[model samples]
Target: MHKSQEKIPFWRVKKLNQMNSEEWESLCDGCGKCCLEKLEDLNTEKISYTNIGCELLDVDKCRCKNYAKRDHYVPDCVRLSSANISSLKWMPSTCAYKLLSEGKNLPNWHPLVSGNTDSVHEAGMSIRGRAIAADDAGDYEDHIVQWPK
Candidate 1:
């Protein structure tokens, strides 16, 4: 079959745990919502997103400055492997990983669907230009936002 006529690939067909590393990594839409610091209500157990991104996250680009060494730089950073995907309740509604975990299809703005890395930013789904670096954050509670939650 021609390259254009080839199948759409298995993101829509395969389960999250069944995907290979490259396929799994490609699922990230670069929304940067996961890079933000989150707050949880001790009483209600509700998770709230913050506009304060991690120190290493490039707020303008919506990407980590040191992705390969992110865990080394920030020990507390939660690694989103297949094993932990189902347990993360704080992921944004637009997150590809979370959507797939919930058995939902990816959105049209996703890079995998749009075939453009900038689609997430263009669709206004990314944290670009909307978040502050954690280094500049004053108080976690003050930075709480409802958009990505």
Candidate 2:
């Protein structure tokens, strides 16, 4: 096809705020890193990630068991939206929302690009087997990890 006739993806042509609900939702790569517990040092204010998954996170699937009602279970749960995308500094660097907001392209292993839901896991990006359920995690400090950052 000619360059003029070539079709562009909605993500490439539309800003985050301009996307419809389906288009916006499709950007999530489902890494589950966002569901992991985090800590911020009082002195440096630097954020640290932990292997401890939220109580509602289904570690194996890298998704929340009660995504629709997560706020009821975990009050502090952050719901990412186009308006709040830029302010969520704790969001993983590999997050599609974060990447696109910063004018970057999605990685090859992203499901949207790979056309496979398991691509994130295959690329070792999802928290599938790495995260320990919060109920079983003894201490958040002890579970501190660097990969999610």
Candidate 3:
């Protein structure tokens, strides 16, 4: 008979500061939805997600075009700091960070769980092959959409 397996202590179980670099990196599902440009209603402070992406985002890859110096190119680029994870309001509802912050379990499609990098894409959660470069998208209004809708 196989012996009982030891449980893996996930980052969600630990506080942000408790996570090491590798654990912190694994938190990302890499859907690239967060990289998309968003509009906030200044009066109500409500945010609307758009299909339009940041100029530095790679449409298919859903990663920063210049990750090393992202802040240099995009002055407002948010560095995913453990210190700010709890307060970052714009993170997607499906994001692992948000899910964990709210004490929810990670979804089955998450790469960390499925051990498949393309699972997000296979689940239709990714921006792959669907995004148009920001520089090429003329009007922000034109890019407005709720993907599942």
Better of 2 and 3 by lDDT: 2
A best-first ranking of the candidates according to their lDDT comes to 2, 1, 3
lDDT of 2 by residue, 25-144 (tens): 899999999999998999999999999988888888899999888899899999899889999998989999999999999999999999999999999999988999888988789999
Clashes of each: 0, 0, 0
Q: What residue runs in model 3 are displaced by over 4 Å at the alpha carbon?
A: 1-4
Best-fitting candidate, measured by lDDT? 2
Instruction: Supply candidate 2's per-residue lDDT for 72.
Output: 95
TM-score ranking of the models:
2, 1, 3
lDDT of each: 0.89, 0.92, 0.82
Q: Model 3, range 119-141, lDDT digits (tens) per residue?
A: 99999888887777888888887
Clashing pairs in 1: none
Off by over 4 Å in 2: 2-4
Q: Which candidate ranks first by TM-score, i.e. highest?
A: 2
